[model samples]
Target: MTTESSDARPLPTLTRRSGDDLRCSIARTLQVLGDRWTILIVREGFRGHTRFSDFRRVLGIPTDILTSRLSSLVEAGVLERRGYREPGARERFDYHLTAAGDALLPVLGALAEWGNEYRPSGHGPSRLYQHAETGEATSIAFVTAAGAVVPLTDIAIVPGPGENDPGVGPTHPLAAHH
Candidate 1:
């Protein structure tokens, strides 16, 4: 099935299998952070928990799983591993968030906000997002290039430049629209 977009172009109907051949940013991102444990490790990184033992203790994650997740994050450029050693002790590594990882703050905030609203625990929010300098509350939204915050109802998803790549040819539905 397909739907006619505003420009009278037919939009591709996506299914679980459709993403397998598509150049999708969300799909690529999920390859790095799809699991609960991986995301929680990122949360720990944001909270300044860098040591392996600190992550294990705080999240109660199994040693093998934590090791795998941390290794994957490092390989994906989400975390940077640096060597640190105390005197007379064996060298160890601490994980720090790279720019790519630090940029996930807004994604984390959006996830938290959605959870608080739709999956409430019946008590209250355990945490809130606020400005560091002004202490003002903040929330994420779809902002236009002109700095206008558009309502969710007004939002639309259209083909980006990636979908319109000339090399991809008309074999891809959206590529034909370009």
Candidate 2:
């Protein structure tokens, strides 16, 4: 079933406190998706499980926890809830991933790659990402704006604009560059 709604409205922007706030993007992202169940729910969404029952059945998530995660996701704009009704049944909602949620594909891919390397199941990957048309295997990487794929060894964490805030102390040696 499709989750697109003709009357769908844009989600509100989430506001974070400025100055003295943790300047870590990863930490900020984790604020919304730090829990195991939240990530698994998003995985289920990618697997095309839109309805609550489907998510419960696939993940074996408890109803209360599943309900809380879905609600949090919808609040965080990761999932959009669309109402539907069947025959004479009351209207219910199906959760679909928003653009923000869909953006987590690479995060999931990277996690899968790491798990396959460090926490293998002894058999092989249960899932593999591939190019839709070419059918070639795909993996996540750090690519530059000019399209250069940088190796992990070459990556350096530099201070960003947020890191330059007066309240935030220089935690990295490169902070002087800003």
Each model's C-alpha lDDT? Answer: 0.80, 0.82
**Candidate 1, superposed: residue stretches over 4 Å from native:** 1-22, 164-178
- Model 2, 1-178: lDDT tens per residue? 1235454444334455753335666666776788899999999999999999999999999999999889988987889999999899999999999987887898899999999999999999989999999999998897887999986666676556766555644344433565
Q: After superposition, how far is residue 139 of candidate 2 from its true place, in Å?
A: 1.2
- Writing each residue's lDDT as its tens digit, candidate 1 over 1-178 gives 1221232211223234454435676866677788999999999999999999999999999999999999888887788899999999999999999877887898899998999999998988877899999999999997887999987666656665668454553234333455
Best of the candidates, TM-score:
2
Clash count of each predicted structure: 0, 0
Question: What TM-score quantifies how close candidate 2 is to the native fold?
Answer: 0.81
lDDT of 2 at 1: 18
lDDT of 2: 0.82
* Model 2 ranges off by over 4 Å: 1-22, 164-178
